[model samples]
Target: MLVKHFPGETIGIIGSSMASALLAQEAGRLGYRVASLVLQEQNPVRQFCNWQTICPVYDETALRHFAGRVDVVVAETGLLSHQDYKILAAITDLTLSDDLMAITTDRLIEKVFLDSQRCLVTPFSMVTSLKDIKEAVEYIGFPCVLKTTQRHLPQSSDHVILYSEEDYERAERKVEESTCILEAWIPTEKKASLTLVRNERGEMLLYPVFEVIGSGELHLKQVRYPANISSMVEAEMRRVAQVIGQALDLIGSLTLEFFITSAGVVYINEASVGLSSEAIFTLGSMSMSHFEATCRALVGLPLPDLLPRGRAAIALPLVDLNYDEVMTQYMMRTDWHFAFFNPRGHSVEDMQGYVIVIGDSIKHCERQIELSRLTHHPK
Candidate 1:
């Protein structure tokens, strides 16, 4: 089970998103040479890595050439097809197994894996046609969520919530043209995620659970560290995460998102084997961040002991704002941390960034968010 160490070695990243940039930054901090393979010529992540190459992921010859130059490869964007994974696995050491990557990227496969483990998951059924949608509705009940089974589909929203027949009728055409999954939408008392890292030695480390707040589109809007759930609930979540990680034989960082019902029932919502967006808050709140932990795990390094400083909140703004202006306004606030991604000539609306505020109490964190609202809007 001894994996290769990556100190002073090259780490290859596959993707050009903000998450990929963060990974490159973390790897650089750990003394690893970073190289990124991107599809576009103007990727913002180019600034964060030591080397960058423009190549399509589907081109196996280009992928092999890129993989040959790195000690290990990590896919930041979960848009890789099954064949792409196979090509990468054949060329280099992947942080995740092909099976794990295949399962975690597809919603239908993920649900089936969770069910096979006897994990508590939301009621779900696959829908490929209008007749299938009706059957799924009958099984999962009304007020459910319809989401694409595959990631990065062409010209489609990731998910939609249907409250009535009208909503379903309006979405029927789109649903019929693509594969989808229908899941009963539980009224959650709290939405939280547990991030864990499994190293090559089979050792696992679990970080503090983060209470998540999302926008109407289900994008994570805010994250609070050290979730306010009971100890028993936290322990249960840890157990479930460990089980899922072990079952997958996962060797990198994984995040399992959960929904806590009013009755205290915990249900698995989804899983991500890549870096989570909440890493910004973790870097501000915990002694070790998810990005750093992921790098450590991939290189056969031991996980660090998590030491939480205080309550931390991360605000994700929906509207585009002047980066310098936002930084200048928050520079005087020593307790606040701001990170703005380089837009690389892209529109601000397409940019992703976060502001982290650490406070002594939850109310103090809330006050910082309220104060920030004077300048930034959700839009």
Candidate 2:
């Protein structure tokens, strides 16, 4: 069902994530009332919400009561189960699609959907045991990642890359512990991500692709707007993004991460239905941030198309370990835009703060990056 929202109408936000809080804030700013449900200990939404219900996310009674208090519902993915999706869909205007959730929440299922849509996907095959993994590796090739289908497992136990048979020992426990899928790891010089938003009428919006600069091991570094890729690669990424969005019947926004090789081969990594901390750059870089754009898309309002407003923008995430260094630079770099999270739901490692540097061109941002010593820990 197509649901259109107007000012003063209650928009029910159904998660405690920062993404949900950001959405609530935007909905409120747009003249809409924001109602929220959150867990007590972690309540980023409480400060922004007009009306709030505090409870466990899966509590049926609480969920129903919360649903009834608003006109439309939006949830940050990972907060709801397949059954919960059915429950909420039946009772209220749940904006996130159950099919999309069902597919995206499971890596194997998501890869299958992407394949069926004729979108590029990393080569993969499910492996159950040492024998299965060894045989699969022959075709999937070396330097492949072994990942558990279930994401809720411990992070360490979930993934291991197999470069050879000796490496299988590292992944043996994961393969034995859960249903696992092995995927060919595309060696790449650049990692890029695209955010896509779709309205109820099936209209969609694509934000500019972001190029993520990280370490050789893929550790965090910084993110630059409008990926420095050839026009052909960018065009193909956009083409697949539209196909995936339309196929998912998306009623909200999601991000797709892609691996771009030095040779310019583009391989889809994975899709995330939940809010991405990586995309926080949109806040300082674009004319319309992802939060506001997602709200507008959900309510059947005009989307601003998320155009880049500046010549270039880069986002640097801060952590607890960098306190002294960040502060020293903070004093010197008054021009930098620094945003600190509310210390509500976020752990220090997830993100203590972030700095966004926007300039007239990529050259200017590059200069700022050197001044900030973004490549090294604040010393």
Candidate 3:
């Protein structure tokens, strides 16, 4: 059963990332009291929350106390499992759709579910041993990616890309060899994602699709809004996303990532729940912040149509590696929008900030990105 709450009621949030902070901020802006369970010693989310419980998520005494005070809970799923959400629902109202969250959070299960729906996911084989990897390589071929089936893995432990058979011997030292998935690496021309919110009543609203322009060597160079894609491709992407939404009977925000092959076939890459860091990519381009749209759904309000606000927008992710370069450009160009995190993490790969620029054309936006010292490889 689904739960509903009024605008003035308290909404509890889990996790301490920027995504969680933005959700809390939007909830507060809409007159809802925010409460959260904090994981980090310092996080921007605490300032937004009316009340906060600073403890491990599964801490019974603290979790129960947090749940007791809130009218509804909306967890950012990366750090919490479906079982944790189930426990939260038992204690109080949890807004996420259990079935959708359960499947989407696990890559292996999500791939299986997508296949079951006849969605075009990459060719993959589930493997538990090196022998399975060799067999999958025989069909999927070299340059495939080997991913652990583990949920909530650290950024560094997530996946290993193999270019040859020698890499398989190297993968044993890197990846968690328990249960994994071997997927063929698609030759992509563009990578894009569409975010949508569906309510229990079956109403849905779609956000502007964005293209990720990355360096082939595993780094996100830039992101552009209203992606450079054909109208036919866009329609197909929307159809696939909505189909998954209806199949799951989802009642919250969902983001579906797609890979466009060199021949222009769009393959479903993955899905995520809640407002992820990727939302920042199209920050100034949307009619309203994604936060507001998602909040309206969370509180059982009617959904609104989200249109592109500007001609185009491009966002460059700032990490310690590129912080100096972005800051130099920031001083010279007063047009770019920046969102920085106050409580920084230990990992350098964690996004430290963003430099977003909205312009009259994608060419204009691309110029800004190029000037920021970020290379945009349109793959």
The TM-score, computed over Cα atoms with residue i paired to residue i, of candidate 1 is: 0.86
Top TM-score prediction, candidate number: 1
| TM-scores vs. true structure, each candidate | 0.86, 0.83, 0.83
Taking the tens digit of each residue's C-alpha lDDT, what string does model 1 give over 51-134? Answer: 889865547787889889988888864567667777887777887776787785688898989999999999999888778877
Better of 2 and 3 by lDDT: 2
Q: What TM value does model 3 have? A: 0.83
Tell me, by lDDT, which candidate is best.
1
lDDT of 3 by residue, 160-269 (tens): 89999889886665444457778999999888898888888889887778876776421246667878888888999999999988898877788999999878899998
lDDT of 2 by residue, 153-266 (tens): 455234787877788777888788888889998888888899988877777778888977765322245778868888899999999999888878887788999998999888
List the global CA lDDT of all models. Answer: 0.77, 0.76, 0.75
Error of 3 at 239 (Å): 1.4
Colliding residue pairs in candidate 3: 189-379, 190-379
Clashing pairs in 1: none
